[model samples]
Target: MNALTPQPSHLAMVPFVSVANMLKIVNRIGPAQMIAGIAAYLEDDFRRWEQFDKTPRIPAHSRDGVIELMPTSDGEIYGFKYVNGHPANMARGYQTVTAFGVLSRVENGYPVLLTEMTVLTALRTAATSALAAKHLAPQGATTMAMIGNGAQCEFQALAFQKVLGIDTVRLYDLDPAATAKAVRNLAGSGLTVVACASAEEAITGAQIITTCTADKQNATVLTDNMVGAGVHINGIGGDCPGKTELHRDILLRSDIFVEYAPQTRIEGEIQALDPDHPVTELWKVITGQAEGRRDARQITLFDSVGFAIEDFSALRYLRNQLSDPGEYIELDLLADPDDPRDLFGMVQRARP
Candidate 1:
């Protein structure tokens, strides 16, 4: 609290994790270990998935991009994220995607933690991908092909390395500089990084294939002849309608796994398929109710569209990590009065 500003009751204050503090949290824990830690939290949440409310994200679409609100609750606590995806922003010297989120108590409708999620989203997205692969990827998978080396490329490589024992990453992007940037970032991460010219070359000898292009149209980053049997495809780029990365034929060949079937049917790679297409919910697989990786020759696809439960788990992990003393600041977010019904008086008292 600033000394010059009028101090409100404790109930009016909320812990706010700024971008700098978020970076502190990530660096203090180490990226790979933090990704693994978040993956563990995700597993715990997924086990009790039915305990929380679930729904598709509410999105406002436009010609340039889309903005979305993702909300969920676990009876005791509620969390929501406000995020936007503007692929054109990259060319305009801005982030293609940015986000912020809040976690609040259910007993009283007050925010407990508010934090920037642009960085956290990248981490949680990678963690979710790694967590799903842990259940669905081919056993003993050593190499991964990361197509579209954008903001998420290095994080995915590090997460797979820490969580799934992947040692080699082959990267390819429409722009050579993007691949170079990812290669430079992953140099000292104890992984053999290879920059490939084509997606076909990137997938050679790679047990896992990750597509994360940032186009807002139906672009086939991977075709039927390109993807073979026994490879786990992590579809990360297809988070909105008409913005898909994999071809329809691949979805037909692969055993699709998704966070929420309803959301995936609308926003994920499965959008190209019929409404009744069969897909295994990732929670069911994590809870051991459904099968993953049925056979070595069977193709597995995690059609991830960044669900609300995953973000909720990420906020839970961040709150836990900040339980100890840290540099996070507090903001006077709520208007608290001595009498619950005297909200107007609270404002009047601040007129000095």
Candidate 2:
């Protein structure tokens, strides 16, 4: 069907990059470098924002957890991830989440990379959070209060410390063990970590308040009274229709910011606000089309729903970084029959 000289092969070769390879790649590049590279690509994509085929995230919700699919492409490369968030997974000796993703070319529909996305998601989520905070948080913000101490807590803390000039993190969670784990992970990073007993204690005098709790309901992790002026709230966990972290009154009082208006309208903290309520897109701030932090008294909230373009940027970055010899394992997703029209003969030859 291609009408070319050499017929296509039945075995289409694609590469599979494993978790260890990814770890090596990420470690060599470092989180700061990766975040910077991803930010540059995100800005470039935002400049040509009209070229992308964007769609809302697809989510499947159950009583215990939710699974989501986020896909996006720019007519050249297509990427999608299958990730599940089950808070109870840890109770059963499994991680609270697991994920995998595929990056494919659009022309011939050949997969270029298939990698585990569980760790990758943690990386990207933190990168996105820091990216937004960099644009929205007050200049020279050094202290942060991380309200959730789950698996993502350490990544978020490091991203902010490395990218946003944050030097101290006040950590708190319902589970003291989780907070202890986060503190231990951050050891030797030259950053101070304070494990507070309550959310109120953690948030006190912090420059940025990051709410990343895993509850899948409309829970108020950040209340109106706890939030003060000039605080940049990075809301990462409330990313579903029924899930939220900030109280509705806080959203009404703060200057809300989001990734994509349409998608965030349903999934972000904006879901609690009226449809007509005004909010700014993070891309606008990145492009210098809109103002971020104008005054010390104005509270800014980044209602992050983890947009597809971020993943696209990340996969693009990962693919570029792993361009050395034999960084991935090749696979055959399609079978080639040597002759385009001799499919029946090939099947007959394989009858044995």
Candidate 3:
């Protein structure tokens, strides 16, 4: 190499986990175990939640979908995810959500890892819900009512099973095909799976109700009359402005928990309530700074809006797993010049 041109080295490459590699990693670790690992990272970070730089995701809304960038930093490392939500995409044979993420060194502002996040987001979202339920749900709760059987349904089912010892899942969706898909996917997963005709039927005898429908409107997937006392609700789907899954009356009666108050108020089911509505911070509960469930009869709701720190935690977990060479490829993403000032010379040398 010339004095002005440095040879490529590990420092000049970024670890990239493609969708295929992600699948291989999931298969190697197993989905439920991978989710549990992510949950462990999430819990550790949330316990020290005060250390993170948190902000509401930046979103650009369109008639068809919304694209968002969720970013956060824990002083030493920075992470962000690029995600899009397009409910209509499923009708055209595409996923409703897709995402990719980057984890970087804060000191040098250089990317350390890049990975597909569409599957990782689902895993972390489910893990976060299960972690919240571990704190807020009634102790020894075994059954969950999964009220939407979309891409997130099976992940939610497995997370609850792995994290909270949930043994049964009752599934319901507006589309019978979606419910059927969940039934097919969860077959022989060691949990009793029941496909129900309606949301009401799904909630029958269930202690945890998880609503994850993908709609861009204020849709009441769960009504106050339908939810009984002593149940924990995981509100997962209504995660943007003008979107919600629970009735306002249910919010008025439940002890609501949220990730970050400012962002959840704008993007969660709590958006239906007053801006200053009383809600518990989940990190406080995890850290024992606040109480979770006061009584079995008290209904608890986790208004999950999918925060950036959760994505950061997920990226951190994925980056840690990159020690397995089979799970990733190195990308020639950065330029390394022997002379720091010879950027043009470095470019000219590549013209061969």
Report every candidate's CA lDDT.
Answer: 0.94, 0.84, 0.94
Ranking by TM-score: 1, 3, 2
Model 1 segments more than 4 A misplaced: 1-6, 324-326
- lDDT agreement of model 2 with the native: 0.84
Candidate 3 lDDT tens digits, 147-203? 989999999999999999999999999999999999999998999999999999999
Clashing pairs in 1: none
Candidate 1 global CA lDDT score: 0.94
C-alpha TM-scores of all predictions: 0.98, 0.92, 0.97
Model 3: residues with Cα > 4 Å off, grouped in runs: 1-7
Q: List all candidate RMSDs to the true structure.
A: 1.5, 3.9, 1.8
